[model samples]
Target chain A: MFNKDNQLEKFKDAETIIGASIKVKGNFQGQGSIIIEGSLEGSLKTDANLFIGDRAKVTANIESKDAIVNGEVRGNIKSKNYLAIGGTAKIFGDIQYGEISVAKGAIINGQLMMLSEEHKRNDKLKPEEKAVATDK
Target chain B: MHVYIYDDYLNKSKYNKTINRIEIRLTDLGLNGKIIRLGGIKNIKGTIQNEIKLGAKTIVAVGNNQTINKIIGAVIDTDIYSDFQKKTILGIIPVGGDNSIAASFGIKNEEEACNILLARRVEKIDLGIVGQYYFLNQATIQSLGTILEIDDYSLEIIKRGEVSIINLLSDKNQSIKSNPHDGKLDIYIKTKRKDQTYLSAKKLLITNPNNKLLVDGVIEMATPIEVGISKDRVNVIVGKDRMFE
Candidate 1:
């Protein structure tokens, strides 16, 4: 049982948390983890992990280091590392990830693209990014 | 040298005992200095500027949040007179209501405030600025249908929430500890559902006209005002019990 609020304790050091009451509609770019529980449109790009809560309704193309989705999304998601799709997740766009875990009841309405290991993105990454991706 | 600027409200007799005790403690600690009552002053910023010119090293505000906020605005405003030898240090003694700023600095009461001042643990802190006023803690506004523009992005708060711009975090329950030494401001947005967000930026603009910016929980100014931190820093006297280092 992934209790939404309780799970937040794990990311207590999160750099940003877009609460359920907020509706963002532009390019939100940053350098740390971001948790979204609200309604968002446009694009989200982060150099770290992203956590989408169960109540969230997002319509943005997302890019992150790692990702966990539990709500509804209508845009493409790109996770450089592992992508964990929870049972209650409802996504409507293509996905790109290195490795992924899909739970029962997860409804995805688009193609799933597994990044090729030959790309060797990890080896090409800057030292700082490799460290962050490993830590996650 | 220490120069205490007493707020006008403290003139009431109810605070006599606290004031007397504070004076005795300050004298005993060899920290007693000139006391100027705000009741007799008209232009606060000018008076403070004159004190800095006269080599007043420490300026202590004796009152609640309003007192501290005024002093911060005044003290920080005096930074242009930097030809002086030392940066004037700002201190506070919480004597009345709305003393959150002082409490964040670990100055709970007038007596404890005196001892904290004696410790003289000075910190260089950032100031949140809106219009001509400055705040040492945080600035807040209602997030009901508010639109904010930061850099190239814009945020529209749909549901009722709170938008806070933090320089120095006073809420111990908050997950992120705000470092006042950092030049950026921490923007915390929380909805009624307890979901929250934290963003750090140098400056942001409120695109909505219906919003009012509440600085340090004391002063309220009209909306659509640009909010950011002052380029200059202030030296503050804090205590060990302070919420943030």
Candidate 2:
């Protein structure tokens, strides 16, 4: 069997592009992995990985399953499992996640919070509540 | 039906051509009978309000993002939000360096956008309310926010006008932390580090544990923030094939 972290395995998933010099102003909701290379002026919600490139300038509240930012973000960010910030990142927002990684030089002038068991349990309750509403 | 054109794009000739082309296409569609030409700012300084008051049905924005912004501002300034919404359908021509909001909504070119507008199926899109302005895109703050204010002169001087977001922060970056404007906002901190590669490279797992920080782009606030989704704020004319997905 091949190693998962190997270079060949890395190519199996190519990052999707939002393109450079582009500007978006809306509610950005999606699934699957996405990489922002341009400017985003809105909110982002996703169930998959989201990567903000160093060249990107994002001004949106982001929610994702996993997120790695190496650019400039001016909003709150949320991830369930992982959130990594590169040295080049200039972020001014809040974040919530289970795991966090910050390189030497990353700039974040917001809040950070790790979800406690109670909070995660509450997060679970939200969907159940939604389900009950939909049932009715 | 009057069409007011605004040309504030970097390329003036291209925008003009798009306008002429649109006029030609409308004429071809036998809409010449309803087409009325007006000066770019003829409706400005209190005239558009009169037309809108008379119940204008369609407002076509023929320039770039700023043109759309100006129209939105005028409508809001005139205290005609509901009136504009009830009687108006906005049509945008993506004429600028980057039309992110337009692109995200699947508005590709001037021709396709015009076709959709003429076809007329109103789709209510969300808008982002930042400060006093209602924007259709995301509002940025902090480092990215500061960069937006960089003057054009500085931009031109720094490598013949080729500047990226990261390049602007290189010289002046510091361990500057911002104080929370309101107690409700989560204050996240990423203490300055010196590593070349990211923490993802080291295979060392780090967890925020506090549930109070906004990491990477994740926000966890104990109290409600001023920011949230605003629904059905702007009316758009989208094609039938366009997918909301």
Candidate 3:
């Protein structure tokens, strides 16, 4: 079993928290980390990592350095470093990531593309660490 | 010079004991200055402005939130707001009920409040401005049929919700804190579907037909209101337990 706490502990430092009762509609651009537990309808771009809670319903194109999603998303997602789709996630958009993890029971209905980088950077990623999906 | 403005309500005999104690403490610390009684004054704003012009460096509110609210309302409206932004400071000595504003400053009781004043640790804090009113806390606007126009985008709430633009929270909730030092204001929306939305904006425009923006749970004004930060931040004496650094 994945240690959910270990996966989410880092986001506790997240400066922006969208609580479960809020529904926002706007292009959100921020430098600080963000955690979404509510609904977003526009676009999201951030320099730091992003976390989507299990019950979050997002309809925004998301761009982040790192992302972990365990909710329902309906737009495209691009992560420069890493992307993790949890078991309960339901995604219906294209994805771009340097490294990716999709746990069992997660649903995706879009194409996935690996971000292009130098060969030395790609070589640093072990064979066991690239596209580590439980079942795709 | 420090000027202590005591709220009119504090004039009631019920509060005589606390008032006497506070006066003694202020005198003991050699921090006492001119005292203004609000009950006898007709034009509070003028009184505050007059004190400012006469070289009162520190303005202290000696009652609850309502007391500080009135004093702040007066202070921000004066011309001195722009000229001496840092030279003048606001202090709070929470005397009676509804003093969450003081607690947020890390001040607990009147005794500690005096000590905090003596220490004179100051911080620049933001305030939410709407027309003639300035709020230290948050502004609540009814979500129904409200359109919030931010810089690059607009937001509309289809579902029932409460929209608040927060400079700082009134209560001390460790769960989440809205930083008063941040130049941006936090936009919070709570909907009926158990959905919550949180974002921050530097400035925004609120358009609501026949609705008003309730500022700091005090003043009410009609909408198409432009809400933004005060052009100049106010210096406030704060304690270590202040909600924001």
Candidate 4:
């Protein structure tokens, strides 16, 4: 049997599921990680990592160091380090990151812009994280 | 051995009263005890983090899902991994914030949770991680996401409420629509013209060969979208009757 205490710590590197019945409206900020298996209408700010699950529906903007999407994301997503959209991903917003890899079958309606050389320099050098948005 | 009490009772008087009662209970039981009342929701994370950092063992929580979520987030966020051996048990009182995770775990009620805590037998359960946070309940994205937008505090107030998975499928606007021809984003569509109840119901169960894919939470008009899960990664705590994946 697992210890009821330290259960959270044991899963320091576990995959998460945000089920379909959950809708969160607040700014969700976390560090270690999470997988959105449900719906989110607010902002997702995480410095650790994120996995947008296949069944997830996110209307909120996302900020992460790394992300993998096999789900549907309607808002903008900004990753400082890495980002990937699975073939099943249906992304409707802009994506800004240092490195991005999209699989062949992904559907993205939003614009895609690689980080500018100066922006990359500024991003890496900046002490705190920065937000990226496509206003147009 | 110090027993730390983490409760969400914001009212100072009530909070103090509850802690005093617990302290009396502990003293009667002949255990070294100290009652630390967790304040309002916002202060919860910081308090738990501080307690764990100070090498406090045995966290006795006194609230529901919202409180648990905050504590879990802080525990992971602060990266207090080194204190696991000392902070080895979680005692919960199923109060406030709907207590969904508590109910699901069969903690029964606040009294039962307290009893279990006093008994102090450790159990392991499944824990879900999203990015860095740890979650005990299942995560959803699309159809269920819509439901989450409804009233939270009110919905939580209900001891029990169930959403029909069947109802979600029967609703045409929410179900599969059409399978677009694209390899990148796999789409599956299921729709039917309104007909007699029996006929429409039967058709609903049948998969639509062509339906647009709702990837994650967005509609996938393209061919195939990717998806996967690491089933082996989740770890959590549960009673002996619990079944883990």
Candidate 5:
């Protein structure tokens, strides 16, 4: 959905969707945003956003640029950018995020760590640092 | 060094002027090649084989999407094409119907196609393969009770709609980075609901007998088919503003 300033973020156009009836059990890594509405038992990693639908059940550690969770997650979540925990979300793992927004009814059973500004900046510069180190 | 394969439909009386204009443009651009009018769709592979044997380095398909797929199929079948892989390049001069493939390559018309051929800017692109057939664009299956298996993921559809395995993003305005050179196919399964979604992977296996598999808008095969990417498969001449990038 394109609005003024083009800042609208919707997972409607997600490149990958894990439907409600399917179950995945492997290390899932890819380039594009992924939507999960089913069951997953793997380490999920992506440089794009991750959307967990309300009916979804995920049992994996999620590493993503951004994430919006409304389902059940049994592992740690590391959002490099923004993480939104919806009202229906039942998260049972430690959370680490650059920026976080949690709804009233969301349940988090583990510690929540707001990433420090210095850490965020360092995370942003890791690629450039690696490039520089490689040049040496 | 170019061999032009014109579709048989161009031989109709109404297309004489259009063909003449194309030929004149080709001559004016100093990019004239051996022109072969296809007698029928069945003879396309054999005609291409004859032209390849005649030492044609570039095979320019002058027709719509179906004609392009036929030429592509001939080129990829090593048993028939006989080792013309890296040596031969494909070009398109869109003549009729929905020529999305030509538009994707940034060739608008006959003159632009000739210009691209003259420029000789060849890009090695990936192609979607279903059995022995090679498709330049996406392939689709429209039916209910279908299951799509890609890599380690499997999606079962109970409602009827369409499942598209996209190789190159046809819509220019589409923001997704679905590239033909990326060696990955974008699988989009659109059902009736607005909420149901799917993902992408390599080596797709669609299991169902109730649907027809359409490659580039033409019904080529049935369901229960396997789709995979053939990487760096074809060298194709593309316009300066080619869409695949």
Candidate 6:
């Protein structure tokens, strides 16, 4: 019984934290949650949640279980579970999410799509069926 | 069984007492194995190959992290032992300077290590591979401002410091809870500028011009390295309070 606020709070104990002054350019994939307060330019995918701090500037495609963004992102974002755009957030890319919440002052300049039920159902199927559907 | 003793520590006159104690403990534990004193770094591969040819099922390293690192390098480079590498069990005694690997397995001293060997409890652990080398603990680079790549993402370090790829999470200050068996490498970047430091990734590729890479705090190698998890590559004797458990 955890709300979005509670879930976001859980990321405070992130295993990886990119500091405000650092700049990273690479592909990052992991099982643990990560918090970013710096600048990153690449792709990021994790089995856990991702927390982007207000001072952060990320120019990378992001895929994660959940995401809470309070920064500036210039790339696509796809969250499997939930996506929260904070008050200070400024995003300029398409967003694909299962569920999402946006703060009143947040700015987004691209498409936002809640994952379709058929897409969700397709996601649950095995790789072979998904491949067959793609062929069709 | 074969025991490869790193003679650098054992040959020292100061450690006669410790060496004697380890010898006595090994004998008392009823573990019969051919003990080979490693002569130099160059001879490591040949020694391991010879032992494996002589039907060695278990190879014990009777020194610190350096000794284990050498054995891992030898086992990985030698083709004769490749097929049987996973089957071969590696043991540690922790008699040298940095015994963090042994310490991670709940083995603080030589006596406890011998006892664990007698208990015969083995854990198949994961190894971090950097090109041809296999490391059990972690690999690090000091000079920063290098671009680290992991899959499709890249992390560019802005400052000068150390960037480490950790395999087995040790007692060292690590925010990430990394398990050696978890088919993932923990990447930690620490910079010289105090507030500017801090970054972690699961896996990364080192594409920098830095020449030196330290593995397990020992074994320095040239870079342009690819780091990843080699699943269940090594079997080691561990105590009941081992790290993974």
Which candidate number would show the highest DockQ if scored against the true structure? 1
Model 5 clash tally?
2
Query: Where is model 4 chain A poorest over a 10-residue stretch in terms of lDDT?
Result: A1-10
Interface CA RMSD, all predictions: 1.3, 13.1, 3.6, 13.7, 3.6, 2.8
Worst 10 residues of 1 chain B by lDDT: B77-86
User: Per-residue lDDT for B76-110 in model 2, tens only?
Assistant: 64677788888777776666544544554457777
Error of 4 at B234 (Å): 9.9
Candidate 4 — which residues are off by over 4 angstroms?
A1-136, B10-23, B40-46, B85-87, B141-245
Check candidate 6 and list the clashing pairs. A25-B154, A25-B155, A25-B156, A26-B153, A26-B154, A26-B155, A27-B153, A27-B154
Candidate 3 positional error at B133, Å: 1.1
Model 3 residue A6 CA deviation in Å: 2.4
**Superposed Cα deviation of residue B53, candidate 5 (Å):** 2.8
Q: Report how large a share of the reference interface contacts model 1 reproduces.
A: 0.83
lDDT of 5 at B158: 58
Ranking by TM-score: 1, 3, 6, 5, 2, 4
Q: Model 2 over residues A1-136: C-alpha lDDT tens digits?
A: 1122541332224333454533545666654566676678878777667778798898889987667788999999987766778889999998898678888999989999996765554554668785775676
Interface RMSD, prediction 6 = 2.8
lDDT of 5 by residue, B1-245 (tens): 88889888888888788789889988998888798888655766777877777778988898888778778777575664545675678888988668988888888887788788889998888888887777878888873677776555456665667777888767687444577887888776666555445566778788777767888787678768899987878888899877767
Tell me the whole-model lDDT of each prediction, alpha carbons only.
0.82, 0.52, 0.82, 0.49, 0.79, 0.76
Question: What is the lDDT ranking, best to worst?
Answer: 3, 1, 5, 6, 2, 4
Candidate 2 wrongly placed segments (more than 4 Å): A1-136, B8-16, B31-45, B142-229, B240-243
Candidate 6 lDDT by residue in tens digits, B177-226: 56787676767676644433344444567766755777777677776777
Least well predicted 10-residue stretch by lDDT in candidate 4 chain B? B195-204
lDDT of 1 at B70: 69
Q: Pick the candidate with the highest lDDT.
A: 3
Q: Of the true contacts between chains A and B, what fraction does model 5 have?
A: 0.42
In model 1, the clashing pairs are A17-B197
Per-residue CA lDDT of candidate 1, range B1-245, in tens?
89999998999999899899989999999999999899889998888778877888888999987887666656554564463225678889888788888878877788888888988998777778888887788889988867778876778887677888888887777767787877889898877645677788888987557878888877888878888886436777898888876
Docking class of predicted structure 1: medium
